[model samples]
Target: MFTRIRMVVLATNAEGSPDLFLTTVDATGTQYEHGRHYDMALPRARDEGYETPMIAFDQYDAAARMLRRAATFIEGGDAATGN
Candidate 1:
């Protein structure tokens, strides 16, 4: 059977909130996905999910940023490993 599941948060972005990524998955082997390796960053990355003064990182590494944000950022899930 196919499943309609919510998008899982991959990681906190350079911005202070969850990086906005969504997907529709065909869990069963009957259907095939159309896209591969799709990535989007706006004309400029923008703050999301919260308007308050949340802390953001300036680092290039996502995992390193997450580690630095340990006290400040709320992790989405384990997918932040960039796996």
Candidate 2:
């Protein structure tokens, strides 16, 4: 399985609040690879029972910018230790 820090935004709903539905992304490799991981995650979620709206990190968005920075940190660390 992939590992990464995920940011989830929860909103209140009539169904007892704290609805457990959110998207995820892998915090490894370049931003492009991160996106690839996201792409696979979406369909997997639908298969497992996720009907809520999800947010994707696009190329020119702040989320993508943040992922890029994270990618730099992760990639830089990997290179240093010969991963």
Top-TM-score candidate index: 2
Assess every candidate by TM-score.
Answer: 0.22, 0.31
**What does candidate 1's lDDT look like per residue over 6-82, in tens digits?**
22234455555554333333333232142211112211222233323223222233544555455243454344343
- Candidate 1 Cα deviation (angstroms), residue 61: 28
Error of 1 at 56 (Å): 20
Point out the worst 10-residue segment of candidate 1 by lDDT.
Answer: 35-44
Candidate 2 local distance difference test against the native: 0.49
Which residue pairs collide in model 2, if any? none
In candidate 1, stretches whose alpha carbon ends up further than 4 angstroms from where it belongs are 29-83
